[model samples]
Target chain A: MNKQLVNIKNVTIGYQSKKVLDSVNMQVNKTDFIGVIGPNGGGKTTLIKSILGLIPIWEGSIDVNIRKSKIGYLPQFNPFDKAFPISVEEVILSGLSGKKHLFKRVNKTDKEHTEVLMKQAGIIHLRSKAIGQLSGGQIQRTLLCRALISKPELLILDEPSTFVDSQFEGELFEWLAELNKQIAIIMVSHDIGTISSHVKTIACVNGHLHYHKSNKITAEQLAHYECPIQIITHGEVPHQVLATHKH
Target chain B: MDFFKGIFEYTFINHALIASLFSSVICGILGSYIVSKRMVFISGGITHASFGGIGMAFYLGLPPFVGAAVFAVLSAFGIEWISKKGNVRNDSSIGILWSLGMAIGIIFIYITPGFTPNLMSYLFGSILTVSTGELVFMGILALVIALFFILFYHPILFVSFDENFAKAQKAPVRLINYSLMLLIALGIVINIRVAGIILVMSMLTLPQNTANLFSNNFKQIILYSILISFAGTMAGLAGSFWLGIPSGASIIFTLTLIFFMGKVLKILIERLKRKQKQFLPVK
Candidate 1:
């Protein structure tokens, strides 16, 4: 196995005639919990999309140690309406799509593995429920199961807490924290103060890069840093805000 | 009972009815995707493109089903490619191809140097003359589609719901897209005989659209769609026999009547549930 899990070097990612991320370079090591923070449309999602190879790598390279199939990803929003009829288990099982044969039957082991992943994500009860019937938090857990189902070497999530509740967000993060033993995770979030404490690395992607070690972040540095911190600090420092970060 | 048995005694009637039933099953299953993906427009485009295939087959003097399948499949691929490339919005591509395919088809038919016959049957199917070969072909296609759904069930569901997440999982999205296209072509080609170009899209869409209102999941809706499609087709076929009317018109009328009936049944059930909820003690 390669020493570096992901080595994205001098990559420029964009859509047609619209350059989003420029000269982005990042090296992900083992057990790295990276937090990406920036404003909306600031190429946070774009950078993640490029990493997932959703868009073409226009200028440079994004090389993962293993095959593209081994990576797990969760998007900011699902591009589907409630009309889509898929069970949570079915949706999660698709994470192992690349590993399974299209025509071959799924075995008992696959079912057991799916159940185990669901249990890990705290959505075992939702295994039988339709994904459309799930609450936002439940949906997030189901998607997490999908990301973890393949035992991915790297897990990438973009704005995971955007639609989830504060309590669920913390629980979700705590649940994600358990995977720090085996998988490297890259999370895109605007919840800077809370998330930075849990992560080992912080990446400020606002059409560029401001990568730093996590514990190095400070309120003073944030006031000057590139992330959207002004909108975050709303007047007097509430105890819950500080506690959520430190706890 | 005697009258029904008398009708059943004829091999032609049995063959045609069975064939139509098989076609309905495939349409009901495949049509739900057609409706959900908002690919009604694409299916409409294929309806027009089938004319081109029909014309070419007549000119070349070969099996039009083969030609229609080839033409429809190629157009399906083209539509898939254009949607993928994002060159233009889906509507424009569908409109352009739809019209061009028809014009070319009409020109081919007009230049054939003889009086055109059986054109109406192609435009609007004549159920009176369905061959056994066509019936078998439809059965095989329906089975193949059903099997395809049974396997690779997850990826198809994922891709249909959310392509971004599907890609994140590195699913064979393009392959799934192609598979869907191929299945759509299979559905159309199989039914292009019993259902005409004029009324096929309605037969494909109406039942599933109606069933979608009543069911919560894909499996239930699919089962409902198939049952509903079968009912409508059978009712229409029976109506056509009794009234001496056009089978195509009869089939579409059956679907329309079923739609209204389904709405009535749904309203009654909803009202009953509300009344029960109102009367019941709080939990």
Candidate 2:
């Protein structure tokens, strides 16, 4: 059965007075791997924020079928202060935080779970290292482990490849593919060529949403959907497929 | 030996020692959070804003600490509320409160009809003059803060590190933020007696920065900061006694000296380890 995880209906959201997303409609199923692509300031991040309930919607509803806690989120790679004194293990374990666990200490089971997630994420060796000591890829991996520690039913990653190396990007996609067997995934990225090959469907968001059923999308399709993004194909001879400009 | 003997002989010295101990514990824990969360500016604003309360209290013939506490808490909450609204720039709002509070304080003090209130104690601190009531309050505050940190350690860490992630996990982010802000305001006001308003920010940040050089672990930094704070306080007390200097100024000077020393030592240790590593044979 295709279990519906989230349904966004006529969703309108934005910063005050400036609408970023309007009448945005999208449905995420249990096994759906959605790649959200849009130009900069094109409301892709706003759509996700609305879906995550981080911002208030001006009009419409976003229904999350699963428990809100079961939706793990990996926010965009912010340039965090390198001097922040926190260990990788501590950062990962923070994922287990909830109303129930607020006053309680992290027990042996939680530690064991963190260890297992770190091992799976290949960050077990760096558990004791502070986040400042880790490379960008290592930090991304640590955050990935944190996003997974809750055993979430749906994972939301915002430009996970932004600060990572190519090697880690490949590994991240592979890991995401493996995780998608059991859970749904919604990834926002500007790299159309890369994400198109990995995602099961595509959502072109530019003030609104155009949900494409198939991962394969043409430049014409992107232009038709009003998503202005360059498509850089990877091959022996790298080429760029620029969307048709109306102006 | 003389200092140790003086602690047993002089009641003022006894009060100073107890005040140092309690203030260290309170500042050490809150300082770690302040440094990690990068809320030093907000803390400074709250500290300065409390001066308004002091001035108002002086004018109204109320205890300065009471006025300071009320003003500090109100400004802290105001800053928190304003920042949440996202209407004004965070730093600009802080600047407004910081200067506004100071201006209000000066105005109140100037208008007061009594003999000129001695502002030195409030501005630069007089640790030796700490009262028994203040000591009791500090003791209770230390206990409460310790209990709060112990019980909500993980949640606090989670929220401090990444507020959005904590919120997504259904953590009480708002409650924790407001509670910590209240605690921070109270901590700043109480410690004003130990380190005057001008030097209190250093007390909250210097030791934590020194500890950060040695260990990047949050808990370790807190522990190290507490120890370092006490040592600096003691050393500063001794220096103040010998040099006939102000206790608060001496304490801040010692802490700054310690921070520089720690930085140099960290550099030396790293160089030594690098040199040693170069001599090792390849595996």
Best by DockQ: 2
lDDT of 2 by residue, A11-121 (tens): 988786998888888999998999999888999878877777788999999998887778888888554576778789999888888677776789998899999988877
Model 1 residue A102 CA deviation (Å) reads 2.2
Model 1 per-residue lDDT tens digits across residues B1-283: 4437745698877877788778778998898888866789899888778788888877777777787888888888888899888679888999988888788778888887787678888788876678888877888898998888877666677688787677766767888999899889768866777778888898778998788778757777778889899888888888888888888889889998998888898999999999999999988
Q: Provide fnat values for all models in the order shown.
A: 0.65, 0.78
* Candidates, DockQ: 0.52, 0.65
**Which run of 10 residues does model 1 chain A get worst, by summed lDDT?**
A238-247
Candidate 2 Cα RMSD after full superposition onto the native fold (Å): 3.1
Give me the runs in candidate 2 sitting further than 4 Å from their true place: A232-247
Candidate of highest lDDT: 2
Give the alpha carbon lDDT tens digit for every residue of A1-247 in model 1: 6358888999988878888888888998878899988777778888888877787888989887766777888888876776566778888877777635455566788889998877776788878777778888888778877787778888898778776877777778787788877888999888776676688888877777877765345565454444577544434443321212110
In model 2, chain B matches the true chain B with a TM-score of 0.98
Ten contiguous residues with the weakest lDDT in model 1 chain B: B1-10
